[model samples]
Target: MVFKTPLLDKPAPGWKQDLPGPNESPSIEPYPPVLSNPPNHVDNVYLELARATVRTRGVGVWLTFLMFSLAIVALLSLIAYILKEGTMPPPIPGIALLMGFIAALWGGVFIWRMDVDPPRDEPIRFNRFRRKVYVYRFHHHGLRPFSRTAWGVRAEVYDWDNLRAEACSVYGPMGSGGLIETVTLAVVKPGTHQVIDRFHFAHEIQQGEMYWAMAQLFMQQGPQALPAFPRPPRDWNNEDVSFNLARRLAPKVQWPAEIDLESRTAS
Candidate 1:
């Protein structure tokens, strides 16, 4: 099934759904607790803000990119050859062509989705200094099917106290027998369990929890309390063709000025 989640102010699902359990801020103790060591955090995105700026590209992006790109080319080629022969599509080839076209359409959509110019990362910044989190997101229209929802870029700010972490898992498309799990920071209404807003945090749970822990530690005790990132950050600034093409065609990380400033300040 395709993955879908309520966006900005859409009422969140009630707790009774079969979805994964709500991973509260530190699962009855989330690993790498507020007092624990950082679990090899690496986000050139930004550890610099008493902040955690994270990427929107989740798991399976690269793999989906490859699969869909190939499907578009191969499927289109098959359609062309069949058309060139001027014969009606046979039973197997006909269904195959239909499936291929759909897959190709989605593949093209994936390419359009990711390959973008700078600032497309939709970076979510958690500023411990200001006790706030600023989300840079492109809110798509949820009324349509999930894949079609790429609407507009907007920045949102929230008080840090109301945010809760939740894990959502969805099956891979075309029955690929794979599971994709992600962590999202849900914004609950002040003093209530009602979630009002949310944004993607980490592609995987453990890493996201670690980032969450580090950010929490920074907010409460300052940056000195957390361990250093395992290595220099890795970002799209390098010369790799994929990176360069992404910069040329689509996504990169650049936070809004107001949020950026407040997130980094001590006062």
Candidate 2:
């Protein structure tokens, strides 16, 4: 004999639902997309420099205070011990104390300048490799008091493709300026994300898939060949891509090369 299970009726439209327990997890929504400026941020030095400006401010202050305090304490202790233990006469103890004070003061001042109110904030640009990372910076205000202020960092590996950048207004007590930041790309092949090398591209690769992640194609095979037939130039049609941006600049980026983005896009 076969045993049949009884059919259960569906719950009413407005019936109160019973939850499994407090141990159950609640549903979560996906994170929002991050907006960025400067699409090619993977190797831009200027973007990293801006980040350093904010980071260094806090570190510099703390280091300056600590070094200065240590210098004062060490100098005073040295002078007191020398006067108490050494053969120096009681009448000339003030000279020993003065010497110790000077030494301590000098060290404190030197550390203060090096740690707080650093000299410059320069521009930089660089490339980041798969196995290794690279960084570059420009000399800011060449010979001024605050010159050559720059810093850089790199990780073992980053996704070169699918990289994005964004621009925003940087605000400080003084005023505001344009600021840009970059996000490194990542991928999980095995259990975790790992860095790879150039040699991995030894097989068949297509135009779209080959180097979309890379900042610029090296073109090892030389320049690509175009069709033999020449095409006539188009009539005055579309507006220039940088027109709006250029008009606002006091001194625009006037490069000698033709700004033929439209033609490049079409081809």
Pick the lDDT winner.
Answer: 1
Candidate 1 Cα deviation (angstroms), residue 47: 4.6
User: Could you tell me which 10 consecutive residues in candidate 2 have the lowest summed lDDT?
Assistant: 199-208
Q: Let me know the TM-score candidate 2 reaches against the reference structure.
A: 0.25
Candidate 1 lDDT by residue in tens digits, 168-252: 5666574657766665677778877677766666655565556566666655655565665433433533425454434454444
Give the Å shift of residue 172 in candidate 1: 2.1
- The whole-model C-alpha lDDT of candidate 1 against the native structure comes to 0.52
**lDDT, candidate 2, at 164:** 18
**Candidate 1 deviation (Cα RMSD):** 7.9
How many residue-pair clashes does candidate 2 contain?
11
TM-score of each: 0.58, 0.25
